[model samples]
Target: MRDLTKGGKDRTIFIGKSLMTFLKGHFERYQEIKKQLGHEFNPNDLIFFNSRGDYLKLRELHRAYKNAIKRAGLKNARFHDLRHSHASILLKKNVHPKVVSEQLGHAKSSITLEIYSHVAPSLQEDAAHAFDEE
Candidate 1:
């Protein structure tokens, strides 16, 4: 619901079924926690919050990400890399550039292409083969 984009523009993006299921389970857990807290629970609290039910600060989020990366044996990775990874995976799978751009909330498909041109060579080969078949 919130715009976390660099341009601060609000946009809608589709989530996969697996992610939707994960979110449903997360919401159920949150509701249970809220019920346990009763009067202490703030209905308007963010889904991601600190132990005290306050919105997580940027540093706190970064610290948690760092800890997770360390635990997962990842090196030289930042939180923003997750976005790059997602887009890269989608592009490599041959999803349309327009769709990828829209999902990434980029103002233009060119931006997506410019950022991810490295993934385009294989897609170009695929396109040439498709044309050959036709």
Candidate 2:
């Protein structure tokens, strides 16, 4: 809803089909719960909300994230790590950096490449193999 952190512009972050399906089911359940409470669901309302139907405060969200991480037996990981992981996975899968940058709402593709430069060696190897095949 708000402008991106770095770019200060609104952009769409496309989701994969599985995520889309999951979101659709979640929305349906939300609507049903609202109906049970004798309230109409607002499509524009935040997808995730606290029990009182408000956006979660940053600290509350962070606390929940930390608990989940601990329960999963992960250490030294923050919610932001998921974003970096997503970008790294895409780069390693040979997705174009420009596309990943757009998805990440980076000011430029170079920023994505700069941050995930460690993925470059694998990409270079893939390129070499592709060239050999050709």
Candidate 3:
């Protein structure tokens, strides 16, 4: 069982159009698979399942993520880094820090800044130019 303190938090992530379409198709297929399973299915089904159609374990998810990066020839990093990347991308676009922190499930903006400050270019811009004499 997941520790409620760690796993019970809710966060919202933006869905791109392509990802939405993909999720729609995935759920359609999921429904079909559920029908094939008939009454054997449980009500608490998982979004991602193992080959035996059981809920996926976290270790399985981590293993697959590691292998995917290896196959793609990318530098390996913790999956947590992806959350930072997403926040950084949003912050770079001048999206609000509170919004980004919420999306990243951070308790505060300080935590977001601590984790993703390097990726946030907002701090690097020279606002001094706004009132410079010609």
The prediction achieving the highest TM-score against the true structure is 2
Pairwise TM-score winner, candidates 2 and 3: 2
TM-score of each: 0.84, 0.85, 0.71
Model 1 bad stretches (over 4 Å): 1-9, 132-134
TM-score for candidate 2, please give it. 0.85
Lowest summed lDDT over 10 consecutive residues: which window, candidate 1?
39-48
Per residue, candidate 2 scores C-alpha lDDT tens digits across 12-104 of 778899999999999898887777755534434779876666678898899899999999998869799999999999999999999999998
Best by lDDT: 1
On residues 37-76, what C-alpha lDDT tens digit does candidate 3 reach at each position?
8646645777778766777789998999999989999899
In order, the Cα lDDT scores of the candidates are 0.87, 0.86, 0.75
By TM-score, rank the candidates, best first. 2, 1, 3
- With a 3 Å backbone cut-off (N, CA, C), the pairs that clash in candidate 2 are none
Candidate 2 Cα misplacement greater than 4 A, ranges: 1-5, 40-44
Model 1: pairs clashing at backbone N, Cα or C within 3 Å: none
Error of 3 at 66 (Å): 2.1
